[model samples]
Target: MSVLSVFVPVLAASPAAVLVQATEPPAATPVQAPSTKTDKATDETPVIVVTARKSSVTNKIDRRVYDVAARPDAAFSSANDVLARIPSVTVDPRGRIALRGNSQVKVLVDGVEARPGVLNNLQASDIDHIEVMTNPSAQFSSDGSGGIINLVLKKKRKDGLNGIWSVRGDDDGRYSANANVSYKTGRWTANASVGVNRELTVTRTDGRQHWQTTSGLETTTGAGRSTTSPRSSYESASIAYDLSPKDRLQLSGNHYRPRALSKDAGTVLITDLSGVLDDHAESTVNPDRGEGGEITAHYTHTGAIKDEHFDLDITYGSSQSQESSTHRLSHTVPSQADQAYTYLNNGRDSSLTIKGDYERPFGTSRLTAGFQAEQNGSDARSRSENIAAIVPGEADIDTAFSYSRQNLAGYVTWQTPLGRWVVMPGLRIEADTWDAGAVKRNDLRFLPSLNMNRDLSDTTKLVASYSHRTQRPDVFQLNPRRIYWSRLYAYEGNPNLVSQDTDSYEIGYEFADKGFSSNGSLYYRVNKNPQTDTRRVTADQVVIQTVVNADQSRAAGLELTAKGKLMKKLDYSLNLNLFDSEVAGMVGGETLRRQNVTYSGNAIIDYKPRPKDWIQLTLSGEGRGVALQGYKTGYYRLDMTYRHKLTAKWTASVRAFDLLNTSKQTDIFVTPEGDSRTVSRKERPAIMIGIARSFGNTGQ
Candidate 1:
C-alpha cells in the first residue's frame, strides 16, 4: 500500500492519464452469444469496478497532450485560457500566441487549419484535448515554421444523451454563456453547440522614439489610451454515421460573427535638435464588423487487413470584414495645421482544401502516403479622405488590391520498429503558385524529416527528430498599396517579400519516478530569408513600418515541464523555456545585428481540503526578448480560482485574473542612424463568478 501511494501520483500527473487515447470502435453485432456460467454462480451476486482517466499531462514522440476537460479548478473558459496552461506557450495581452519564444505558431482544429479568431470563439468545455507539436511529423502540414497547436473536440461516444450548460460574468462588464448537447444511438451520433460573449477592455500606450539622422537627432514622444467593446457569437453542428462495420462518414459546420468599437485619445510631441516642440493632440474612433463560416466533411474506410486504412477530408471556408476609422487632430504650434481624416477598408477571403491519405502494413513496418490540393484568395479595398484639409498631399485616395495562391503537395512516410526503438522517415514535395496584381511567383520545394524514439527502461525514454518547413509570405505582405493610418504614420507592402524556410532539430527525454512525471527537450532552428517587420523614417520624421526579407537568423532553446502531487491534498505543475536568438540583416548596404537570451515560465498549485471544494493559483510571465531590429521587455501575471460543488448536477466557481495588474510590454529599436523606444501598459484586474450544470447521463 505504501508503494502504491507513491506510484499512483506519477502515472496520474500527465493529462493523458485523464482522457483515454483514441481507438477504433468495436464492430457492431446484431446478436450476442450467451455467456457460460456455473449454476452456483446464479445464486450469488457479481461485483465490478470501473475506472476513468483523470485530468493530467502526457507526451508522445512528436508532441505533448494536455487534458483539462474534467478539471474543475483549471479555470479554462475559452481556448485562450486553455493555451495558458501549456508548457512553453504564451498568450499575450492582445491574445496573440507565441510558442518557444516565437510568434509564428500555427493553430488547428482537429488537424485542420482554421480561420483567424476561430479559437477565441470556441468554449474550452468543447475541447477534448490540446496537442502541442514542437516538431511535427510528415502527416502534418508544412505551412508554419514555429510549431503547431491542435485542439481536439469532444465527441459523443456513449449510447445515450449528454449535455452541459454554463454561464459567466465579471466586474469589467464581460459576460459569456455556452451550451453543448450530444446524442448517440445505434450507429449514429449528433452534436450541437453555441456560445455568446460580450467583453469590454481598456488599454494605454506611452512611448518615445529618438532618431539620429546625418545632421543631429530628432525625437517623437506620444501616449494614448483606448477602450474597446466587442461582442461575438458562434454556432457549430456535427453528425457522424457508420456506413458499415469498417466505414464511417462525418460532417460538420461552424459560423462565427463578431463586431467591435474602439475610441482612443492621445498627445504627441516632436522635438528637433534645438529642443523646440511641435505639440499635437489626437483622438480617433474605429468600428469593425466581420463574419466567418466553415464547412467540412470526412470519410474513413478500414480494409480487411489489420492496421490498413484510407481517409478523405474536404473543407471550405469564407470570411468578410469591414472597418472604418475617424481621426481628429489639433496642433498648438501651427493652428492652421489642425485637420480631420476618415478611412474605410473592406476585405474578403476564401479558401478550399482537399486531402486524402492511405495507410497499409508491410510485415513489421507501416507505410502511409497522402496528397493535398489547396487554393486561397483574398481581396481588399481602401478609401482615405481628408475631412478638413489643412496640409498638402491630403487629397482623397482610393485603392484596391487582390492576391491568390494555389498549392499542391504530396508526402510519404514509413515507420518501423527495431529491438527497443522505433524509426520514422518522411519526405514531402510541394509546388506553389502565387499571383498579386501584375506580380507572379512559382516555386517547387522539398521537405524531409526523420524521427526516432528509444525506450531506455520501464520508466524512461528518449526521442530525437529533425524537419524542414516553410512560412509563405502573407497576402497583405505582398500587396503594394500604400495604407495611411495617420498624417505621421503610413505603411506600404513590399512585392519582393519571399517565403521563410527553417530547419529544426530537437532531442527530448521523458522520465517518471515515484509520484512525479517530467519531460525536457533541447531544440535548435536555423532560418533563411527570414521575414521581419522594419521601420524606416522619412525626411519629415514619419515612420513607415513594412515587412521585409532579412538575411538570416538562428535560435536555440530548452524546454522543460513537470507535474505531480506534493501532498495528499495538493498538486503542482511547472513549465519553463529558455532560449538564445541571433539575427543578421543588411539594410541600405549596411550590416546590422541583434542578439538576445530570453526565458518564460508558468507554475500552478492546487489544494483541495474537501472532496467538493478546491482552490488553485497560477503564476506565468516572460523575460526580455529580442526581435529582428529591436528587443522587447516582458511582464508577469498572477491568477487564482476557487470552485465548489453545490449539488450532483450543479457547480459554482470564482476566478481572479491579472491579480497584480502588472502585465505590460516595452520595446527598443536600434539602428546605425538612430534608436527608438516604446512602452505600452494595460491594467486588467477583474473578478468573476460562474455556474455550470450537467444533466442527462452523468457517466462519461
Candidate 2:
C-alpha cells in the first residue's frame, strides 16, 4: 500500500478504512421509539459536496480558473467565447460584456439577473465559462459599473445523460441552429436549450459643424450612405431542481425578435443650400418583441456560530413587453410626411429578498458579512401619431400617453483580513419613486465603498479602490414625449430628470501562476449632478432636449489581459481597453472642454492537433471616438471561428460575425440644429454551426 496507496484507490477503499472506523463511530448504540428515516429532521445538515462552486484552492493574484471540463481544447462558441479572457472585458455597440470602459454593466446567468436590461438576451452558442469578477466580493450585486460578468450554466456532476446538438454556417450574411438537453439523478438535476438566427449590414459617413443661434448664424456640411437588412430570432428554456445539499429550484423562458429594413437618402443645408431626395425615399422599418418567466428558490445553512459560515437566497419573478413603429418621411421639400408609433409595455416586477452571509476563519485571517433587499415595479402605454401634408390639404394629429414606476433598494457588505492586508467596506441605500400623469418623482440616495488588497508573494499582487455611483432614468426615458417622427431621427422623451452621480479611483497590478496570466489597471472617474439638456428653437416650436443637471464629467482608463499554454496543444488570449472622457463646455461665458476616445478588444487562438482534435482563431473589436449631441457614429469589427472533434460524443462548430464588414453610426451635431443629422447603430450579422453529443460527466 504505497505510492499514496497506488494513487488513491478510493483512498484505499475507504469507509473509514472498512468497518467505517476511522475514528469515533462506535458510540451510536441507543435507539428509542419512532424511527424510519424519511424526513428525519434533527438539525440535519450533511452532504456538502459541490459542483457549481468549482473546486481547487488558492489561485493567487489575477486568480484564474477554467475547467470547461478540462478545456477539451476549448474553441469557444459562446458564453462570449469564454468572456474573451477577462481583463477590461469589452463587446460594446450592444454585443454585451463592456467592463472597464463601462456600458453600465451587471449580467449574471446562474444566480439570475439577465434581461433586456439594455443588453440583448443571449446567444454565444448557449454558453458555459464566463466569470470575470474583476475584484467582486462582498456577496456580489454591486450592479456592474464595469465588473461582474458571471454566466455559469453547464451542470450535471454525475449519474447519467448529457447533451448538445449543433448546426452552423457563415460568411456573415447570417444563419444558425442549436439544441442542448441534460439529466442527473442523486438528489435530482435537469436542463434544456434551443436557438435560431439571421443577419446583414453596411454603413458610411462624413461630417462638419459650427453654429451660433438666437435667430442668428449657421453653417453645416455633410456626406451620407446606408444599407441595412436584418431579421434576427432567438429562443430559450430552462429547468433545475436539487432539493437537498441545501435546497435549489429554478424555471426559465425567453424569446426575442428583430426585424429591419432601411434605404437611406440624405441632404439638408440650412444656409449653404444642398437638397436631393429619394436616396431611397427615406424608408425605414423596425420591429422588436420580448417575453419573460422566472421562479426560483435557493437556500444554504451552516452552524457552529462560534466559527461562522452561512448563506441564503429566495426569489420570485414576472414579465412582459411589445414595441412597434412605422415611418415614411421624404423631405426634398415635397410635403408628404407619414409617422406611426405604438408602445405597450405591461409590468409585474416582484421581490422579497432576504440575503445574509457570514464567513469566519480568523487566524491567518478571513472575515465577511453581507446583506441585501429589493422590490421593483413598472407599467406603460404610449401612443403617438402625426401626418402633416399628404398630397391633399392634409392635417392629422393624435397623442395619448401613460406611465407608472416604483423602486426600492438596500445593501451592506464588509470583509477583513489583516497581515498582508485585504479589506473591503460598503454601503448602499436607494429609494426612487415616480409617477407621470404629468408629475410625481421622489429621490433618495447614498452609496459608499472602499477596497484594498496586498499579497506581495506567490506571484505578486497589489490593488486599491474607492467607489460611489448612481444612475436612474429609463423606461421610455421617463416618457414625456417632446417629439416623435421616425423613419430615422426625431425621438425625444424626457420628464425632467435627475440622478447621476459617480466618483471613482483605482490602482492595480496582478500576476498569476501555472498556465500563466497577466493583469493591469488604472482608473479615474468624476461625475456629479450630470444629466444634461438644453435645446431650443421656435417659429412653431420643436424646442426639444430634456433631462438636466448641468454637466461635470471625467473618466480615464487603461487595461490589459493575457493568457498562456503556447504549446501542450496551443491556447492563447489577449485583451485590451483604452478610454478618455471629458464633458464641460459653454460658449456664452467662454469655458470649454470636450474630449472622447474609446477602444475595446478581443483575441483568441486554440489548437488541439491531437486529443479530441480542434482548430480556432477569433478576433473581436469595437471602437468610438469623435462624437457630440447624443453622440453616435463609431465602428470597427472582426470575427471568425472553427472547431472539430468528431468523436468521444461528437462535436462541431462554425461562426462568422461582422467579419471585417464594419458599420455603425448613431447621430449628432446639434448646436441647436445647424444641421447634419441622421444617425443609427446596433446591427448584427450572425452565422452559426452546430453538432453535439455528450453524456454523463461531460463536465469532466
Candidate 3:
C-alpha cells in the first residue's frame, strides 16, 4: 500500500501577476528556517512579499484546489453560496450542484459521503478547502458519472483552546448563528462545530400549456405563489489520537435536523376557440421534517512497512423523514366542483460502509489497492386519501416499499513516471446486489481507467484520461408508486429501470505563469441507458412525469477556465463550458431523437481598495439546452458583496444576491403525442448583513 501524494492547497483562480499561485516549482529546493543572524543587506532592505500574497489557487494531477479559507466569501453560511463563487461550478435554484454541464456529481466531506443537505447545513467558514476532481483515480469511489467534489474541513491546530463565533441576518427574515471550537494537547486533539439557521422565502411561477385534442389545440394558463420557512440545525465533533508518529486514529460524528413549513396557492384558466371552459383555484399546505446522523471511525498507519502505507475507515449513518401535505381545489364554470385531499409520506434509511486501502511507492512508481463494502437499506410508506371530493375514492391508496442494496468493490492502480511523462493505469471490480420489495437484481461489473500527463514545459502540462463509470438508480427511483400533486398532474417511479453506464474520455492542457493560470479540455462521453425525466399524457387527460432510461446518449464538450489578478488590487476568475448532447430513445413505442447545444459561464471580480476592505462582483449564466424530454430556457444572475475588517478581531460584511431578479428557471416539455407544457419559476432576491468576531489563535 502507498499513501496519496500531499499537495499544498492553492486557489483555483487564473494566474495573475498580482496574485501568484502558492505552489513552488517541483525542482525547487526547500528553504531553511530563519536564523537570528542578519546580513547588512537584509537589514537595509526588508522583504515585503514573503510568499506572493499567499496564493489561494493550486493545480493537481487530477483536480483543481480552491482555498476557500483564503477568499472573502468563505464566511457565507451555506455551501451553495460558497460553491456558486467557484468557477465551473453552478448551484441551481433548488440548491443542487452541477459541475460543467452535468448534475450527476458526488459530493464528499473529508473523503466520505455525508447526509443529504449536509452541505446546506455546513457554514462556509468551517471549510478549509475544496477539491474539484474532474477525472478521479482508482483510489476514489466508483459512483457519480459527472465528477467528484471534496470538501476539507478545518481542524484544530496549536495548543490550548480556541474558537470562533458568528451571527448573520438578512432582510428576508433569515438569520443564522455558528460556533466552532478546537482544543489540542500533545498527541490528542478535539474539534467541534454547531450552526443554526432559519430562513423565509417567497417565490412565484407562471406558465401556459397547449394540448392537442381531437377537436383542436386547447390552452391552459396557470400562476402560482409559494412561501416557505425552514429551520435547520447542524452539529459535528471529532477526536483524534496519535498512537505513534506514524500511527493515528480518529472518530467523528455529525448530526443534522431540518424542518420546513410551506404553502402554495395557484389559479388556472382553461380555454379553447369556443370560449373559456373552466376556472380553477388550488391551495396546498406542506410540512416536512427530517433528521440524520453519521458516525465514522478511521485509522491510518504509515511506515508500517518500508515505503508502504495502510488506511482503514468504517462509517454508519441513518436518516428519518416525514412529510404531510393537504390540497384543496375549487373550480368555477364548466360544472363547478370542490375537492380536498391529504397526502402523507414517511421514509427511513441507513447505511454502513467498511473500506481499507494500502499503498506502496517504489522509486518513481507508485502502487495502490483498496477494498470497500457498503450496504444500504431503506423503508418508505406513502398514503393518500380524499377528505372531500367529487371524484371516486379508493380504499387501498396506502403503499409500502422496502429496498436493500449491497456493493462490494476492489480496485488496483499503478503510476509509472518516465522522464517528463507520468502514466496511471487502474482497474476496479464491483459486485452489486439490489432488492426492492419483490424485485431483485444482481450485477458484476468491471471498470478500467487510464490517465497520462506530459510536462510540456516548466509552467505547462498536457494531460489525458479515460474512464468507465456507472450511475445506479436511487432507492426512490426504483419504487413503483404514484405521487399525485393535483388532479391534472402525477409522478411515479419505474420499477423496471436499469443503471446508466458512461464511457468518458478527455484531453486537456494546463498552463500557469506568475499569478495567472489557465486550462482547457475537450471531452467526449457515450452513455447507455441514460436515465431522464419524461412527460406523457394519459387517455384520461392526466399528465404523468417520471424517470425513464433512454436507449443511448452522447455528449461532447470543451471546457476553458482562467483565474488570477487583473491588477495589483483587482482579482478575477472566469470559466466557460460548452457542450453538444444528443439522445435517442423509444417513447410510447416510437423512436425519438433530439440534439442540443448548451453552455454555461461564470465570472468573478474582486477589488481591494484598502488592506481592510474587500468588494466583489460576480456574474453567471447558462444557455438554453435540451432536457430529458424537452428543452430549457437560458438564465443569468448578478451578485455583489463588500466586507470590511472593523478591527483585528471583528469583521462586517453585506451581500446582495440576484440584483437583477432575472435568475428564473424555465423549462418546456413536449410529448410525442403533441402535448406540451411550459413551467417557469422565480425566487425573490435577498440582501444580507453579517458580523463576526473571533477569539484566541488556532494558527488560522
For 47-158, candidate 3 gives per-residue lDDT tens digits of 2222423346677666788888756655555777888878788876656688886788888887777568577788787787889877777667768888888888765365
lDDT of 1 by residue, 479-525 (tens): 77666666566787888888899999999999876567898889999
Backbone clashes under 3 angstroms, per model: 6, 9, 20
Per-model TM against the reference = 0.91, 0.29, 0.92
What is the Cα-based lDDT of residue 675 in candidate 3? 51
Off by over 4 Å in 2: 1-81, 84-90, 94-97, 100-167, 170-200, 204-590, 593-648, 651-678, 682-689, 692-700
Model 2 per-residue lDDT tens digits across residues 1-700: 0001111112222344222211112234353333346653522323222112232112332223444434442323545545544445656544556666566567776544665421243544345455665545434554454456766655434467666555555565555455665667676656665655454555554444444555455544444555556554555555556555544555555555545554444443334233332222434344544454444444545445555656565555545555545555555444444333332223333334445566666564455555556455555554534434221222332444455545455555555676777866766666667665576778776677777778788776887777776666555666665443332233456666666676777777777766676767787877665555444333322334444444676778877767777888887777777778776745224344567887676777777787665666666665653332445455556666565677766777665566655645555645544444545443455666655666555521
Q: After superposition, how far is residue 259 of candidate 3 from its true place, in Å?
A: 0.3
Local accuracy by lDDT, each model: 0.81, 0.53, 0.81
Query: Compared to the true structure, candidate 2 yields what TM-score?
Result: 0.29
Root-mean-square deviation of every model? 5.5, 23.4, 5.3
Q: Tell me the lDDT of candidate 3.
A: 0.81
